[model samples]
Target: MTRSVALLAVLAVALLTALSSIFIVDERQKALVLQFGRVVDVKEDPGLAFKLPLIQEVVYYDDRILSRDLDPIEVTPLDDRRLVVDAFARYRIADVNQFRQATGAAGDQSIAVAGRRLDSILRSQTREILGSVSSNDILSSDRAALMLRIRNGAIRDAEALGLEVIDVRLKRTDLPRENLDATFARMRAEREREATDERARGQEAAQRIRAQADRTVVELTSDARRDAEIIRGEADANRNAIFAEAYGADAEFFQFYRSLAAYRASLLEGNSTMVISPDSEFFNYLKSDLGTQ
Candidate 1:
């Protein structure tokens, strides 16, 4: 009975040792087998891996790419203008051994520790590259080039920490809250001033056109009136010449016509007040029908 109990204890101990020696690694994980606090082997493959029963241990780490969203950081440009920039980074652990050494992950991989360090590197590069140019450059479409520069600059430092920086992107860039109101007001005023100047120029052009038209009208009227007066004077001179020719042609008939006109004037309808001699020359035409023509 004592031998039977001893045999059962030996079998149990062997089973426990075999169970502890075997470990399964998943497809998404890369593992490091450590012996007495030091790495003895690296198992980047999936499936069962064997290690010494009570002397070795297995540590797992994620082998996929990772991303971190960084907080907004303030930077000043060469133009002495302050701007706020928000950014994000993509990275991957390319060398697990170097990563473990750099991060001191001998026992376990702390994502927080790696992330904080990466965040610092990204912020530093962002500030350095962005500060080299003016604020206008940061706000313009040249931003893609600027972001590429920041990513390139960060690659070197991140590699020291066993991280490969895939890309660095600027999420948003903007002016501070204290400057928005002043900038907007200045822009509004400039637009209004331009509008006012345009209106004034238009009004001045219209006035000039109106004045020219008025002057042309006045000149036309003056010319027409002068021409009419000249025509009237010519007509009066022609009439006087015709009358002088007629008077010189026959003095007797002209005098006879004048005497008849004078008689008609003296003998009126409501006023006949001529007191003259009966043998006067004024009555020659009426005194005898055809006096002595």
Candidate 2:
């Protein structure tokens, strides 16, 4: 009975020792082998790993790429204008050994170190890039180019820290609320002033065109009146000249005929006042007629 109990106790201890020696490393995990408080090996492959019971320890680390969304950071442009810039980045561990050397996996020291490095790199890069450009450029199509520069800069600076920057992108860019309102108001006023100036120019041009048209009308009207007056004067002169020519050709007959017309017109009047001799040339036709009657 004593031998059986000792055998059972030995088996239990062996089982516990075997359990302690066996450690599991999943495909998503990278583990470091620590022996006597010092890391002896790094295991990135997925499988079962062996460690001495109560002598070696294993530390697990995440090997996947991580995303960091930086909050909106305020920066001043070259023109001394303030802007809020929101950015994000994707990074992964390139050198697990160096990562572990710099920051242990316990207590999130690795992530904290990465976060600080990323923040410092991002802040310095963003300030440098934004300070060299105008606010309009930062907000406009140049943002693509600026993002490329930022990513390149991060990749260059963060590689020594066992970090590979996959991409850096700007999510949002904005001005302060007060500045936005002031800028919009100024732009509105400038556009309205330009419109007013254009309208004034258009009106002035229209007035000039109208004035020129009125002058042309006045000139045409005056020319027509002058031409009509000249034509009328010519017609009157022609009529007088024709009559004079006919009268000059037969002066004695014209005079005798005119005197006979005058006697007929004067003798038929309602008021009779004859103060002429009977032998006068005015009564020649009247007297002959009277004799014949």
Best by lDDT: 1
Q: Write the per-residue lDDT of candidate 2 for residues 122-163, one digit (tens) a residue.
A: 888988888888998898965788988888988888877778
TM-scores for all predictions: 0.69, 0.66
RMSD of each: 7.0, 7.6
Runs of candidate 2 with Cα error greater than 4 angstroms are 1-20, 35-37, 100-113, 133-149, 152-161, 227-293
Q: What are the Cα lDDT values of the candidates?
A: 0.85, 0.84
lDDT of 2: 0.84
Tens-place lDDT digits, model 1, residues 159-269: 888788898888899887777777788889999999999999999999999999999999999999999889998988898787677789976677788887887787889
Clashing pairs in 1: none
Candidate 1, poorest ten consecutive residues by summed lDDT: 104-113
Cα lDDT, model 2, residue 215: 100
